[model samples]
Target: MSATPNDPSTPNTPNTPNTPSTPDASYLVDGLRFAFGTLTVVPVRVTRWDREAARGGMLWAPLVGVAVGAAAALCGVVLLALGAGAPLAAVCSVAVPAALTRGLHLDGLADTADGLGSGKPAEDALQIMKRSDIGPFGVVTLVFVLLGQVAALAQAYGDSWARGALAAVVAATAGRLALTSAAPAPVPAAPAPRAPS
Candidate 1:
């Protein structure tokens, strides 16, 4: 059911006197640190891993993408300027992110493919994904997806290297923004139970 105007939980309503508050400055910084540390090879120290910090981190994930994408775009631009072919430039663009992120997203994609391809029950699918080894499905998906990325970027670079770089930035930022958007909102804490009489 849709929330009513009178609902106490409805946030940011014009009439609602108590809307949800934003994270403090310190928490915001912590969140950004967590996002960078978790998502990239950039060495950032994140001391807070609590729920609040997690929400902050999730909110900040897309910002980390800006840095990642810029770095990747730089690699491609530099390669192209150094007399590298479009294909080579594309390869470097893709490789830069994989190296920086330690192939974390690629591994996730593989695991997801394995799980879906198994056509098993949830538990079995989870087990299949948990295994360290990549199955046929994972291998196929990774190969094709990586190839597709390279091909697309190669085409883009052929059109204009600057456009390819800009595309890289946009793609990376949008991908991370998707992660942030998909993150579950933080739930309020439950009150402690009253002592028995």
Candidate 2:
């Protein structure tokens, strides 16, 4: 009888040379690229989207926050240097982060609020969130949140420019750090068991 492919009598053919799965960049660089690509309007090319890359990205997310916050702070400081009022500076600072993120963070917040406020079954609530238009709940949430941020920043800026800039940086960094801490790390799947001969 001819030897079967899986039989010990059959010799194994040489396998093709192994290729690298990840890009040439180091793991840390891949993580930074993923973090910036996802979190900001910065034009970073993400080379990997695997679980390992995501894990690294999440860990590096706070750095993106730092950059965004610095930009916001700079806008506020510039406005102040131009002799603009504290409220206007606050508004511009608030707008800078929103613009940099392409309003993604605000959109997510609004969607989440709408979904929770629907008070329907999980499926229905999810559908409400998926709708393109903002709901009443979303509108109210966005208004109040934006108002609160503007007010707080105005107060800080009225006190001192340095205080306002520091607040923006601290708040942005804390928000990103919170998200990173809340996210669950990706777990590897267990290998499947082989059947007995």
Per TM-score, the best of the predicted structures is 1
lDDT of 1 by residue, 153-197 (tens): 899889998889987888788989988887875343233567999
Q: How close is candidate 1 to the true structure, as a TM-score?
A: 0.82
Q: Model 2, residue 5: displacement in angstroms?
A: 28
* Superposed model 2: Cα runs more than 4 Å off: 1-25, 185-197
Residue pairs of candidate 1 with colliding backbone atoms:
none
lDDT of each: 0.83, 0.83
| Cα misplacement distance, residue 50 of candidate 1 (Å) | 1.1
Question: What TM-score does model 2 achieve against the real structure?
Answer: 0.80
lDDT of 1: 0.83
Worst 10 residues of 2 by lDDT: 15-24
User: Cα lDDT of model 2 overall?
Assistant: 0.83
